[model samples]
Each structure stands twice: as C-alpha cells, then as structure tokens.
Target: MAALYVLLAMILVVLLSPLLTPFNTSTQFSDAIALPPSWVESGNMNYLFGTDDLGRDMLSRLLIGGLYSLGLPILMVAVSSLIGMSIGALAGIDRTIKYQSLSRLFDTLLSIPSFLMALIIIAILGTGFNNVAFAITLSLIPQFIFVTRNAVHEEWHKDYVTASRLNGCSKAYLLYRVILPNVTPTLVMQLTVSLSVAIMDIAALSFLGLGIQAPTPEWGSMLARSLDEVYLSPWSMVLPGITLFITIMAINIVGDSLRRALKERVNS
Candidate 1:
C-alpha cells in the first residue's frame, strides 16, 4: 500500500540518519572526487551514492541535509499555527468592530503570495535556518489565521457556545475549553496542509540561495551544488533530486489523507 511504503521510507530516514551520514564528509579527498555510484564500483562501500566534486559522500550529505531541510519547516509550521490560531480565536470571540477590523487585515495578508512575502522577509532578515523559519512562519500565518477564525466564528454561533456563555463561562475559558476542542479537527487538517507548504517553500528558498548556506547539509543546497558536475556524474543530480521528491511526496500524501478524513468526519 502507499501508506506502507511511505511509513517504511519515513522509518528508514529516521533510523538511518546517524549511520548513513559519513564520519568525515568535510575532509578533502581529491582522489575520490566525482566517483560513480556504488553500483559502478566494485568493493567500495565508502561512496554508497557516490562522491561530489569535493569528494563529499552523497549518502551522508543527503541524511544530514534532509535533517536540516525537514526540521526547519516542521518547527516553523507548528509555531506559526499556534500563533495564528490564538489570534484568530481571540478575534472571533469579539462582538465588536475592532475584531472585524483585525480579521479583515488578516484576510488581506492571506491575499499576498507566500513566496513573494517570504522572499521579502529573507531579503530583509538575511539567510540561515532561523531566518528561514521566520519567513516560513510569517508566510503561513494567514492560512492558519483564516482557518481558525472561520472555525471559531462558526462554533461561536452554535448552541453549545451560547449555552457555555449562559453558564457564566469567561471568554478565555470558553475559547479554550469549548471553541478549541470543537475546532481541533479542522486545525489538524489546516496544520497538515501548512506543513507541506512550509516544507516546499523552505526548499525553494534554499534552492534560490536565499536560505541554507553551503557546507551545511540541505537538500536544496545539495541540488544547487550538483549542477556543476551534473554532466560528468548524472547521479549527483539524480540522487538528491530523488530524495527531495520522495520526502515531499510522502508528506503530501499523508496530508491529503488527513484532510479527507477530517472533512468526512465533520460532514458526518
């Protein structure tokens, strides 16, 4: 099944991360530079996927780079989702003009393209993982905000929310206890979609040289580096490109399934 393959791939990456990364990929070894894949080399386990022009182990770099690539987006999506959801929930609890004004501003923000917004942020803040996370979070905040605001607004109009308010529940308690739980199914689906988008955006930024720097293992940077020797060792491009593709595909598939399941449950 597709799920089984994805699960297996996920497990393989996590379990093999430590073992797969070469012990000293930084050490220069010109003699081994641009070696073909192991399939082409007899009695050579050193370069499983082969070596780059700098003789860096492709397999090792893939693991370390993948860790960097995946980790940033995961953290960015989580923090942004929490922040956006909180703001949206608070805005929905308002019965006045101020809340509606804030909600409209959030809607305006959602209208901007995330990539352009992130590009501007990166241009202002500079590169590195922290900057990447900041850009990604900012770019995705509107999505979570919109989802949470709408969910809370709908829940606020429901009988249960009115009943809670009648029972002397404070706005804070009502939002946390009554509104949040009801909206969680929706939130999960939103988060999953946001996470996938964040990952793609992070990778795009890195590919454009506005994200993670060189000598630091990252899927996009690796792809960028491979271009020079791509003609000589096509595997240089093939391996890292495949790695990025598979990881993104796996995340997307999982997210799509979650979204479908959540919608079905809500409808039922």
Candidate 2:
C-alpha cells in the first residue's frame, strides 16, 4: 500500500511537473548557477533543490525527467504486453508450423540479453527517441511472448480448459475468458519484471548516449550530464540517482506485494 501510494505520487508529480514549476527543463537561470538546496548555507528557497551548473532548476528538471523515466516505460510495457500477448495466445492455441517457428524465434531472441538486443536494434536504426522506444519495445516483447505463451499453453492442457473446450467453448472464448484469468497472476508478475527491465534499459541507453538527447532532461541523461560537475555540485548526481533508485524500489515492492496477495488468494 505504501509502495502503491509512492508510485501514484511519483506519477502525479511527474505528470504535473510542468505546472509545478515556473521553469521549463531547458530554462536557464543565469543568476542561480550551481546553487545548493535551500537548506544549504548559500541556498535560496526559490529553487527548492537548487540549480545545475547551467543554472537550470534541479527540481524542475528532475520532476520533468520522471515523465520520460517512468512514463515512457509505462507506455513501452503496455505496447509490448498487448502485441506479445496476442501473438503468444495464438501460438499457445495453435500448434501450426508457423507458430512453432515463431516460438523458436522468440526463444532465440530471448537467449540474447535484452540490452544486447536493444543495442543491436539501436545500432541498426540509429539513435533517437522514436528509435530507442522502438528498440526497447521490441526487446521487451519477447519476454511477454515467452511468458504468456507458456502460461496459456499450460492452462490449455489443464482439465478445466479441456472441459470448457469440450462444452463447445470457442478457441477465442477459451483464450480470452478462460485461460486468461488463470494466467493473470503469472502475467502480473511478468509485468512487474518487464517494467523494471524497461526502466533500466531506457536509462542505460540514455546514459550511454544512445537514447534521449541533450536538453531533454531525461533522468539518465541528467545523471550523465551531472558526472562532469560531480565535485562542484554533488547534489546534481545524488538527486537523480536517488530518484531512480526510489522509483525502481517502489515498483519492486509493489510488485512483490501484489504477488503475495495473489498467492494468498490462490491458497485461500
């Protein structure tokens, strides 16, 4: 519950961060360059978290960056889940040669680490927000495919599914209405894992200079930019690092809680 609240609050702050601050991400305040947090001796209350080397408000940038950090991954996971689950369900229900080939392909892709796969795709596509998003989303899809396919396949072979099918339930009905419910707990677990993967992948890409570009204030990019001024303004690095850690930790906790709840539900 606490993790859920944190996640929700983070989402709200990021989504409304633009309105929350008087400054835009790139807006520079020449007078306040490298100021410390307001609590610091020389700090100004006007900039709650202080300013970067470029005089950009750290709070504003961090808040805005969260949109890319968490928001984009949320979107990426959703897209991957939809496409992967559809293909996985079809493959689960039908043992056609084409589906078998696709399963092999999925396995092959999954064998390669997801970051490596995204790097290969990004290398081929070249770097940009669209390309990175595409690369990451594609990398994410196979895991969903593997999980959903196996889950559906396992459920399909179960007695309940056989009884449903024998009672004239259509394949579509069985896949959607019957198998889907039973497999949801597994899928939910996978969803949390996928979200963490998406977040790290995107951040790693940006940190490596292969994803979001400069002036965008992405958390990963912000951290990368802060490295140069680490000694001068340690808070710059600390702020984004802590934010990323907290966000990921919150997500993991929430995921764990949900899994425990679902497990208890099953046991009961």
Pairs of residues clashing in candidate 2? none
Cα-based lDDT at residue 180, candidate 1: 80
lDDT of each: 0.80, 0.91
User: Which one wins on TM-score?
Assistant: 2
On residues 1-268, what C-alpha lDDT tens digit does candidate 2 reach at each position? 9999999999899788879876787889999999999999999999999999999999989888888899999999999999998888899999999997998799899998889999999999999999999999999898988998999999899999999989999999999898887787888888998999999989999999999988898889988999999999999999999999999999999988897888788657
**Candidate 1 off by > 4 Å:** 1-20, 41-43, 263-268
Write out the backbone clash pairs for model 1: 65-217
Per-residue lDDT over 1-268 for candidate 1, one digit per residue giving the tens place of the 0 to 100 score: 4964874676567556877666565755687888888888441577788888887787787777766777667778888988898878877788678878887888998999888889989999998878887888898988888898888999998998999999999999999888886687788878767876887787788888998888887888878887888898788889878876777777767767766776677668
The top-ranked prediction according to lDDT is: 2
Using all chains and alpha carbons, the TM-scores for the candidates as numbered come to 0.87, 0.97
